[model samples]
Target: MLLPRIIPVLLHTKEGLIKTENFSNPKYIGDPLNAVRIFNEKKVDELIFLDIEASKLKREPHYELIKKIASECNMPLTYGGGINSVSQIENIIKLGVEKISINSSAISTPELITQAADRFGRQSIVVTIDIKLSGLFRKSYKIFDHKTKTTSNIELLTHLKKIQELGAGEIVINSFDKDGTMLGYDYNLIDYIKPSIKVPLTALGGASKLSDMTNLFKKYGLIGAAAGSIFVFKGKYRAVLIQYPSNKEKKLLYSLPYFIS
Candidate 1:
């Protein structure tokens, strides 16, 4: 069986690397380059760097910063935020980014997904959907737009189908409600959308322990498991630290039951 990709997601801002809860209350952590260096030592499967303010502030990606991080990173890198054009995608690829993740742009101008896939190959494009649970019962999932900070009327399954049909090679679903809670993933959310997804899929938000990843794999099989708080914080106090699963733990995780070879 193919082992799942364990990724550390770093949120970047003008200050530096930061962590957020429920997509609010950003706390400064440390430098992006420093985080990359540590992840390199950990020999992580892949890394995702998201410029949290780029789209909200209406500015371009920090190419210089991204270039520096990419150059220092040993594992494959995926970058997102304020990516709206083919030229920007080309330049980011030139700077060594393995994949470009688009959220806001994919909503405003979905044609860009096809355009980018055509120019850079579908494997180079990743579409991220930020979802928030709503309704009086809190069971409904809606697409949350980071730029506007509002939920759209679009249906979650409809949007997923649209992007996949538009040539998105991979899809990442992030739970705004679960972001940084580390309570474990919203399994109901995954079960809701899993059947509709055909391409590679990744889940981010609310992963607190290695066992959470194992449970996800045991239930769903191979899929990317990305987390922020679990990788950056330690213990009940949430002390700042940078770490990933060691090779020994990873071997054990893959050997756990329910995975089909």
Candidate 2:
């Protein structure tokens, strides 16, 4: 039986590794390399490192730093931020990275998605959509533009269908409101968006415990549990700690029924 992949979504700025609440107030956590080493030891399913400043500053991905991280990672690594061109995607893949996540570029210049997919194959290209709901009823999908520091009015389901047509291998649906909240995965958002796209989908933000992951997979079918705060912080005080599920914990998690219906 297929198992839902559990992934840790690590964020880094120019300063180093950090965490954020609702995509604001980034708090420094620890060294990126150190976290990768620990994840390697824990045998994580996969890892995602996103440079929060890359798109805001309009700079290329830090290839050297990515190379360093990829070298230490025992599992597949996916890197995002400032990835605007096909050449950059090729370079990142050359550094032993398995996937390249495109966000802002995918919105502004969507052709880059198709271009990169053609050059590197669709499986190597992932699109991450940061979303925020508008108004009390949450009727519309607001696409968060990190570079502009504003949200765009786009229909969530329509945008996702376009992404699939663009040949993206996977889709990461990130919640702008729930990021770093550690509340739980947004089940309503998953249900709303899942039927539109056929590709592998991953949910990030608001994942506080292993049971949250179990619940997501059991109901959602094949999906990825990508989290930040829960993996790095512990207890009420939220102390910084690098951790992952033990081998036994992982065995039980993967063994859960992946499809409920």
Candidate 3:
């Protein structure tokens, strides 16, 4: 049986680490490099470093910092932000990173999904989608041009299908309304994407407790699940002390009948 995965998401504002609620108000956590060293010692399954400012500034990912991170950290590292081209993904893969994930760039340029997948192989490309709840009916909301705040998810079903056809290996469905709030994963995202794509999927945002995660395994057939807030903080207490469930807790969640069903 494949062991379920737990991942930590590190957000970067220029060069510092931060956290947020519903993707707004990113609070500085600490130096990202220092945090990586700590997670390295803790034996984390993987690390996701997303530079929130890279795309907004139209600058490439800070590869210099990435190289040091990949070298020092024992786990596989994946980095995103400002990734908009074929050569850029290739350049990052060459630097010892295991994968390259893209979101805003793929949204703006539809062809990037196919180009990156074809050049790097499907397994190396991860497509991340950031969504929010739109209206009283609780529909998924997609944002285009984060600067202008235009919103829609009407094109999402079609877009997800296109990326799957384009050879992308995995998808990460993130909820803008739930990030760092640690309430739980957006369960509806599973209903939204389950029918369109035949690829491994991971859900992030709103994962606050062990029951929240157990509910995810019970409700969704997602191949993997992730939470930055739950692994890094405690409920209402809101401390920076990092935590992960012991081996037994992981077994209970992974072996639940709902997970296999």
Candidate 4:
């Protein structure tokens, strides 16, 4: 079995790294570039930088900051926010981003995914789904920009599968319900979506500690784990440190049986 990956999820709000509860209250932490520098030195598996307000604010990603962060970090970076067109996607690549995670744009013009993956290769694309519970069995998937709300889970899943067939290398699933709460990831969503998509899926949201992470990796047989608030914060879980698991903790996570069921 492949060793599970530990990824740091950074939320960008007007150029600063911040944490939120249920994707609301924003508390400034530090400069994003500074966080990138520190993560680089620590040699984390990968870094995911998401412009939280870009989609809601209806603005393109901050290229200036993207370049600044890219120049300071050596880890593979995945970036998303305010991407709406093929040109915008190309512009982000020009800024030195390794992968682009798109949401609002995908909801607007899904053909764009095929266009991008076809031109840049599947490995360069990552489609992120920020979903929330809708009903007893249904769920809501959002694309951001405030108005980009899509609740057709079937359509959303179809889009993801189509993008993968169009050559998307991977998919990142972020749960809006669990985001920033540090409760734990929405495992049922991950499990439900996993079987339908062919590409590897990375689960994000509601991660608070090493145990939450271990349970996620072990319980779901997930190889990619991403968290934002859990890494940030210290103290009785102060929620500002933004650090990765120590080597020993990782060894413990990796030693779990491949199939927990």
- Best TM-score goes to which candidate? 1
Q: Could you tell me which 10 consecutive residues in candidate 3 have the lowest summed lDDT? A: 139-148
**Candidate 3 wrong stretches, greater than 4 Å:** 136-140, 143-147, 256-261
Ordered list by TM-score, greatest first:
1, 2, 3, 4
Error of 2 at 142 (Å): 2.0
Clashes of each: 0, 0, 1, 9
Candidate 3, 57-108: lDDT as tens digits:
8888888988877787788887888899998888888888898888887767
Query: Each candidate's TM vs. the true structure?
Result: 0.96, 0.95, 0.90, 0.87
Sliding window of 10 residues with minimal summed lDDT for model 4: 141-150
Deviation (Å) of 6 in candidate 4: 0.9
Whole-structure CA lDDT of model 2: 0.87
Residue lDDT tens for model 1, 153-222: 9999999999999999999999999999988887789889998999888999998777778767778753
lDDT pick, better of 1 and 2: 1
The TM-score that candidate 1 achieves is 0.96
Q: lDDT of each structure?
A: 0.91, 0.87, 0.76, 0.77
